[model samples]
Target: MVLSSPTWRERFRAGTVIPAHPLALTEQRKLDERHQRALTRYYLAAGAGGVAVGVHTTQFEIRDPRIGLYEPVLALAAEELRASDAIRVAGVCGNTAQAAREAQIARDLKYHAALLNLVALADSSIAEVVAHVRAIGEIMPIIGFYLQPAVGGQYFPVEFWRAFAEIESVIGIKIAPFNRYATQDVLRGVAESGRSHEIALYTGNDDHIVLDLLSGYHFSGCDLQIRGGLLGHWSVWTSCAVELHRQVRQAVESGKLVDPKWLLRNAEVTDMNAALFDVGHHFHGCIAGINEVLRRQGLLAGRWCLNPAEDLSGGQAQELDRVIATYPHLVDDQFVKQNLDTWLS
Candidate 1:
């Protein structure tokens, strides 16, 4: 029986288009409780309908060394969200057992769903991957993930996505293959699954945000539309991202074509993403760049990360500075500054 209310699809339709979650850290390379809570408040105040933690943006610090911040950080987010209407989505990765344990932690902490990352199954057959997802479905409601190869990508045939969608507990999918074909593969899988309405598709593709949101995917049987984003890119310039997302959502939901200026805005978001994600360095500095945004706003003392290899790349700051100066409308730094103190207090 379905135990969740409003379901994941309903939540997406109700203006949760931009979930402005951020990577978690302080300059000390640890969970910054004050900053963590501040980030949560900032997302809500900035118009995010929900928040996600424990995903890639949060760093693998929680588990890579067993630093034990997973539950604490998730618990902190849960506390901050308790009084609000925003739903909480906690990310779960690893093998079936590990994923289940992590998911249980999220459920026990009162998260609404799990962002299921089905990776490290490269050697496993499509059938095996489908089985793994089904096993996890028994543990909690799932949001399927299609991560890019640059970041521990996983591959399952289009058929696997079709089978996975038929699972009663799966609610959404975050497609970020960074490949249009593979992205289309998943979309086609859902369209063919005969359960299109049951599963929501969210774009994690930082490179193709506007088109993903604005362009409806047509299949022989059914049409699939990307609901919105569950992206690391949104971690920066959050308030403006929230507004931009809402505007896009209104147009798409109303079946209207947005102006060219709106489409052009995506290039700006991508520009900011390039600097924040450190695309120049193959995204090695992604986490650090996100922390840098917070650091400038006083949320973090430095751009520290769990993996030094993933730390800020040389010249990334110069690139970020250039983007910030040239593309003022692309960031919400001022909004963050205006509410920083209130959030911290």
Candidate 2:
């Protein structure tokens, strides 16, 4: 039973808490195939609507010439998720040829779409970026990304997104511009392009996940809203993230919106993200912090990143410890621990 691109977009809007996957590694920094399967199985059982690999959470380590982990990681995840009903999105970056090749590889491996991270071509003009996206669209549908600058975010204009939205191959977007103004700009373009319904809007806004999901926008005579989340923060405590999405979706369906209890929970999640991301350290500690939680659950052996220097910041471990202690229920470590052996098997 193969799923088409549109089926994948429907899943994206249907509360698919697509957490960007962190590459699992052995202590020796080699790809851990066992852990990779474990992570995919965990997300599937946890009810993640989809899973994204080769993204920021997976680290740029895959791209390093010396390590060259890109192929193995995606291949492993694709094999693990080959039968999944959930959407499979592989991150695509670099210049047009590189991105096109990545998209081709993902298609060959049966991924449904590309989470197009146009960040690598930071200096490329709007036309160049559009050209790059158009080239990859030849291979698969694109989930356009507006990543934050702390991680080499691109400053794409509304005009650029308007053109992108008009393209038949651009089926979804992860709006992580990480700025209210920039996010609205993309929304306006989508609305104006008269393709709001065609393009699934997934928020990567970790700071405003609740608001982004619940708040409906009025732009260009079109009503627009974020469908779900594709977040790095959701990588940890995945089942809880799925539950949170269910709660939020229930709220949206109920019509009596703005429930105070859910609002508080959202803020709590943000605070936990601040700790997990190590906001004080400019998010340099984020991936390690996620792995740290997985490590404790026995899903991973260590917080080992491909880059030697990519470990946590000075107080990141302490910050993670504090967050875990403070929000014991939020971590959902018990659920993973209970199913750890099963998922590993």
The number of the candidate with the highest TM-score is 2
Residue pairs in collision within model 2: none
lDDT of 2 at 209: 86
Q: Which stretch of 10 consecutive residues in model 1 shows the poorest summed lDDT? A: 13-22
Clashes of each: 0, 0
Worst 10 residues of 2 by lDDT: 6-15
Model 2, span 51-93: residue lDDT tens: 9999999997697778888878889888888887888999988
Q: What tens digits encode model 1's per-residue C-alpha lDDT throughout 265-329? A: 77887788889888899988887888888888876666777665567899999998999998887
Show where candidate 1 strays beyond 4 Å: 1-9, 13-15, 18-20
Listed in order, each prediction's TM-score against the native is: 0.94, 0.96
> Which pairs clash (backbone N, Cα, C closer than 3 Å) in model 1?
none
Quote the positional error of residue 31 for candidate 2 in Å: 1.0
